[model samples]
Target: MITNFLLDHSALVPVAILLVALVCAVLGLLFADRRRILWALAGVSSLPVFALTLVPTVHTIDEILCTVQFSVPTLGAVELLANVALFLPPVCFAALASRRPVTMLAAGSVLSAVIETLQALVPAIGRACDTNDWLMNTIGAVLGALIAAGTAWLVDRRAQSGSSTGAISS
Candidate 1:
């Protein structure tokens, strides 16, 4: 039955889809010079994965605990750290790779929020879409963006200083 199928692998299906998308985004960013287009594509690609988190299901607290336990020993820490970790790296990478930090951060945050909302809708996920998650995700993305900005600034400053000193003069 459709219900049975949804029950059996719903969690995994979404996670798998998202993971594939993430991989593709990373590959595209790394190989492609069209940074803006890649960023936009990455942003758009995250939506369905996030939305999957929101789908209603029969998840119980015990189920959530089991999932967390397999990956991390401490459930409490996982709740706090997992989402932040999940969100931060890609945001950082995207921001660093792209010319537009604000746009990347905004897109990442929005996608995260959408995922949280979708998760909230899924009663089976056993996790409510908390405003706290959104806030934390946004903060993580901002931190990533700041790091990217700092790196860019340092690179630019070094380049300018080098040019002024004719470091490359033949």
Candidate 2:
């Protein structure tokens, strides 16, 4: 079943993933600040988003149409999970890379919607636009934003505690 997925999908997926990794490594070297590095990573992470969704794949339908189906639980667990995982890392890096998690979340949500719209409007992409995919992606983005916020809070709490002890010692 897993191998069947590759038959219809673009063969360049593995190559794209590797290329994204290389780009991230290159960007990491160029950025000095931690937040800047994270932002670069976030941008690099979005490569897969386009590679996966926009790449032309083998299609059975001869006619191209733009249609959106509402979120339906018809997809298999694996496909659903994959959709969610797709957006998670990018948004996580984006939120962590910036002072504004909400802005990142909004951007992520809009990105998801735009991707879906592209799939619908562009027939050459050989991908169907589905609301379920957008919904799952948004959920993943939300989770990523929450994780970033939580991580920042924890780090701040630790730093504040350490500073308090240092101040007392002084």
Candidate 3:
């Protein structure tokens, strides 16, 4: 029933996937020291989101030819927000894995560019190759990376403070 609902409302697919990713990310926080769990969860949850992004519909090569356009005329604020939301998990997970903001940002931006390029080059994919999506996706990635990095930093700082206080008390 849930699958059918998501299929019927294609826009809901990414939202659903994002929710699942968030759950995994929260679970990952429990194992903050071992980032591998975060990576695994994000990777596994991201598969469906990736598939949804590449899902083939009507063959429309016309969109691919216009991939350089910075703005999508048909897209509204909601769509742009959704684009950003869709990529948050992987970006956050990448940050957790390395705690490197630059690495996470680059990875997210590169991944978005690659996906857009693939959509443009592959006619059968039926996905629109829009530069706006790349922009939004990159923004999402950076945002997620910042969030993860900040959280990790806070955790480390708290631990350090606690250890120091303990030492002072001793």
Q: TM-score: which candidate is best?
A: 3
Clashes of 3: 0
lDDT (CA) per prediction: 0.56, 0.68, 0.71
lDDT of 3 by residue, 15-51 (tens): 6646745653565467678878777856874675588
Candidate 1, 16-90: lDDT as tens digits: 334544554455435345567656754664454454355455655432221111232122343433354446556
Better of 2 and 3 by lDDT: 3
Worst 10 residues of 3 by lDDT: 72-81
lDDT of 1: 0.56
The TM-score of predicted model 2 comes to: 0.74
Ranking by lDDT: 3, 2, 1
* Alpha-carbon runs more than 4 Å astray in model 3: 1-28, 58-64, 72-76
Show model 2 residue runs off by greater than 4 Å. 1-33, 60-76
- How far residue 29's Cα lies from its native spot in candidate 2, in Å, is 19
At residue 31, candidate 2 shows an lDDT of: 38
> Lowest-scoring 10 consecutive residues by lDDT in candidate 1?
64-73
TM-score of each: 0.53, 0.74, 0.76
Q: On a 0 to 1 TM-score scale, where does candidate 3 land against the true structure? A: 0.76
Span of ten consecutive residues with least summed lDDT in model 2: 24-33
